[model samples]
Target: MKTRMLKIEGPRKLVLVEKELVLEDDEVLVRTLQSSICGTDKMYYRGEMPPNEKYPLFIGHEGGGVVEAVGSKVDEYQAGDLVMSFSRSCTFADYFKTKPINLQPVPEGLDMRIAALGEPLACAMHSVLESGVQLGDTVAVMGMGFAGQIMLQGARKKGATKIIAIDVLEDKLKLAKKMGADVTINPAKENLYQTIMGLTNGQGVDVVFEAAGNQDSLNACSAILKHNGHLVLYSWLTQPVTLNMHRWHQNSFKIITTTLVHHTKYERIVWSEKAMRPFQQGLIDVEPLISAEYKLADIKEAFEESVNNDEIIKIIIKP
Candidate 1:
């Protein structure tokens, strides 16, 4: 069968074209309902991604859909089952196939639209879980983008008493406040180091998440981390960026790199469900992050608008 999918022809150029869909013995075919534009997708679109791909590569990695067909080798899901898939490839299409291990069954009452976000949410949950964020800790998220916002929410759920959200945009800062950030700072307007120090009584935050993929954030991450604090680098820096190791060495901070793709297949399946449970209960809402939506045919326009609009948190495409 033929499926319509989004392809990245080159930097800043996206095309929606029909492609052949081949079924694999161990794969289950999914009719994509909703797929959202992720930070990695934006990086690949703008030529900022370090990991290169062949031309016309399938672009999306976050989405949820219904099972259209079940392979003979698959038994975890059947046709017509509502499901979400992550850390897999070729998600931006009317139909895509995945191994049973990568698919997570969506709870009966969950919203499928937000279930599409399971990948990003799972990454945030992993970071929070690994960071060892505990009750009464002071946490600071260095960005207000999708993953950063979700991590801030996760930090709150982990029992943080003081949560500081940092971003360059005023609108995102407003959204951070709504998402339970006790403090929000625009690095452009206020000194990020000063704000973190002030919020933590000059001791710095117990946990600092570096979501901005730049050297400035890298340097500031160490500065804001308290002695023996945990620092999670959540953003993928495609380019070579310098880091100040002096503070890291002096403070003995535990710096860990967080990535959803690096998790084992079994770990992803476990966390994907744990991550989506709150959203399933309507406790952690994702409605504020969805800034725009488009049909598969208009994905090029959607990508262009999302790039120009820095205020956009997430954009979903319907197939």
Candidate 2:
């Protein structure tokens, strides 16, 4: 069948192009409903991600849709089931094929639009767990983008006290506050180290999350971590960045790197179901963070707007 798909035909250029999809024997063809933009998508759009994705590659990984057709081997879902999927579903298209292992049936009464965001929330959940945040622990999260904001929420749910949110954008800081961040900081306008020290009684935070994906943010993550504290690196820095290992070594800091793609499909699904349950129940609301939505054909414009507008957080593309 013919469908519209986002094609990365060249560096920094994404265009909606018609494509034909053929389902293999083990795959299920899904009619794309809603696909969300991620921070990694932004980095790929700007040609920063390494290993150089081949030209004309489809560009979406997080989304939900209906089962259009099931392969002969697929028995878990019928043709009309509603499902959410992650990691290489290529959901930019109106209809795409994925393995049954990748698609999870959305629980009853859950909004597919928000459920499309399960992947990011799950990754944030993993990072938060890896950070080893304890109740009453002081935690500082750098960056308030989609993933970072969710990470802050995860920290709050982990019983973190004195949760510090840092970003250069004032609007994001406001969103961070809405997401239950105890304190927000704009490093451009304030000193992150001083504010974090002051908030934690000069010992720095018990844990720090580096979600901003930059050298400066990594440095701040190291500086803000207390002795024997945990530093969770959740960002994917596309370029090679330097770090001062002396501080980490001397302070006995523990650095942890976690990625959603590295996780097994079963692991991802279990954690996603648990982490996204709060959002599904309206307890953890991310409505304030979804700044824009666009149809599949207008995704290029959506990406451009997201890059140009500092106030924009998460942008969703509906097919």
Candidate 3:
């Protein structure tokens, strides 16, 4: 069957192209239900990270769909199964086919809208689950974007006594307050280090999630980390940021990196279910995270909005 798929000819150039898809014996065909834009997608789209032959060449992954058809060898999933792409397969299209191992069934109670953000949500939640955020521990999330917002909520649910949300954007900081952050810090306005130090009584926070992914946020995280703290790297450094190694060595910080999509398919499936459980149970709501929705045909406009609007959290495209 032929379907409309997004193809990035080069940086800042996205065009819908017709592609023929054939199901292999071990693969499943999925009818796209919801697709969203990702930071990596914006990077590729803006020419920050040029698409190479090996990775993110076509810039489409954040999405979930229902199983339209399953191949002969696939028995674990059948037609009409609610699934999300686990492994990389260009997903910004009406339909696409991939290996059964690459498809993960949405959690039992999670809404399709939340589960549709499969990879990103799983990644952020996984970071929180493994972040060593214990009861009464003071935590700081260094970004209020999509993943940061979710991480803030997860940290709060994990019993963090004082949750600090950090971002330059006031709009995100405002949302952070509604999302359960006890304190919101806009580094652009206040001195991040001094403010966090005051909040923690000069001891620093127990864990700091580096969700902003930049040199400044990284530096700020290092400065306010406790003597022995957890630095969960949720991935991203926008444009190849430099790391200040002084505090990193003296503070003896525990650097943790969590990106669920980078692991084995089985791990992605298992971790995703666990990571998304909170959302399924309504302990966390992703409705606010979805800032806007656009039709698949208005694909370029969606990408353009990502560039023009920093307040836009997650943009979903329905085909």
The top-ranked prediction according to TM-score is 3
* Model 2: CA > 4 A from native: none
Estimate TM-scores for all models: 0.95, 0.94, 0.95
Q: Considering summed lDDT, which 10 consecutive residues are worst modelled in model 2? A: 48-57
Better of 2 and 3 by lDDT: 3
Candidate 3, 69-164: lDDT as tens digits: 988999989998999776667888999888877778888877888888988888899999999999999999998999999999899889999999
What would the per-residue lDDT of candidate 2 be over residues 1-319, giving only the tens digit for each residue? 7888888866678888887888888999999888888888887787775676656567888888999998898898889998887777888889888898887788678887777776776677678766788999898888989878877887888889788899999988988888888888999999888988888878988888888989999998898889999988888877898887777899998878878656787787677677666777776667777888998878889989978899998898897
Going through the candidates in the order shown, the clash numbers are 0, 0, 0
Give the range where candidate 1 is weakest over 10 consecutive residues by summed lDDT. Answer: 49-58
Q: Model 1 segments beyond 4 Å from truth?
A: 52-54
lDDT of each: 0.83, 0.83, 0.86
What is the TM-score ranking, best to worst?
3, 1, 2
